[model samples]
Target: MDNRVLYERLGGVFAIAAVVDDFIDRVLSSPALNANPLVREAHHRVAPAGFKYLVTEQLCHAAGGPQRYTGRDMKTSHAELRISEDEWQAFLDLLKQSLDKFRVPLREQGEIFAIVQSTQTDIVV
Candidate 1:
């Protein structure tokens, strides 16, 4: 069995950051997610680079990398946006697209999905 942590398997910070960069760009440009005025406003308010940085940090930490996530909790970050089930699914679809773009293997995708799923309750209102 492969003994390396998910972070290492994912090629550590650089690879993970690349994925996050794509994912965040996809998210920020998604009409489905921005349909909600609150979400649209939030997306417009945040700097894309900083948003990517936070997401990369979060994923890196979740995947057992050395970086610590310094962003707010999922609930606090998403609470006012009031994300819906459909919107959440749309977000997942974008995530899948990003992972596919990176050619991330099934195992790594599953692990990443698990981490994202764990935060769903906090993110979805």
Candidate 2:
């Protein structure tokens, strides 16, 4: 079975998108994260749909789906962000809330979280 289908059976890309959107919003609003301030570009604020799309693309590929993410590598993309452990923790917190809100089963949540976590190498300061 396609990973996308499995993710769909679990919830689908839309579900992941929704969670990511909420997570981004929460992260942007919370100052508890000392590092990794919101992206300065006006575009990132006015509309995160593009970022959301890229996130989903990365996710689909990470989950063993058919889609491929041709976007910039995490290291290159996040190089300028200068994210820190606190900011990364904030992201994880928001993601946890989203997963809980979505009521994703534990097993599937772990799989998806693991995929999101794959970027740790680049996301951390």
Candidate 3:
């Protein structure tokens, strides 16, 4: 019901987009992530718009955007990739770097990280 909470949660779509851009840039630049064929050629180019929407919608809902996440499940999409532990760690590290690079506040970072972390098992297995 509170628009301001939603705004704060979402941080505006542009803010979320900025963070995503930073994160994706870092991920792309990281040798660990770039080395993966799925990421390098397939996932990287194709996933951004969906990713952005995912973040925006989740943040908006978490922060109080109205839209519920009815998207495809994570495990289904990521399970086949067979991501290794090292690569998973690299993904997380770059994610942290991206948030830090953009100066996302600690609370916000923690919140976002927690939300993202929820997908780890599905994504990494």
> What's the TM-score of each model vs. the native?
0.98, 0.78, 0.75
Query: Best TM-score goes to which candidate?
Result: 1
What are the lDDT figures for the candidates, one per model? 0.95, 0.70, 0.71
Segments in model 3 whose C-alpha atoms lie over 4 Å from true places: 1-10, 44-55, 58-63, 68-71
Whose lDDT is higher: candidate 1's or candidate 3's? 1
**Candidate 1, overall lDDT?**
0.95
Q: How badly does each model clash, as a count of residue pairs?
A: 0, 0, 1
- So what's the TM-score on candidate 3? 0.75
Where does candidate 1 clash, by residue pair? none
Better of 2 and 3 by lDDT: 3
lDDT score at residue 61, model 2, on the 0-100 scale: 68
**Models sorted by TM-score, best on top:** 1, 2, 3
Q: Which pairs of residues collide in candidate 3?
A: 60-65
- Candidate 1 residue 52 C-alpha distance from true site, Å: 0.4
Candidate 2 C-alpha lDDT tens digits along 5-90: 54665565677677777766675566665333444443354456677778777776676566688778989887777777776777
Candidate 1 lDDT, 1-125, residue by residue in tens: 67899999999999999999989999999999999899999999999999999999999999999999999999999999989999999999999999999999999999999999999999998
List candidate 2 stretches off by more than 4 Å. Answer: 1-6, 34-46
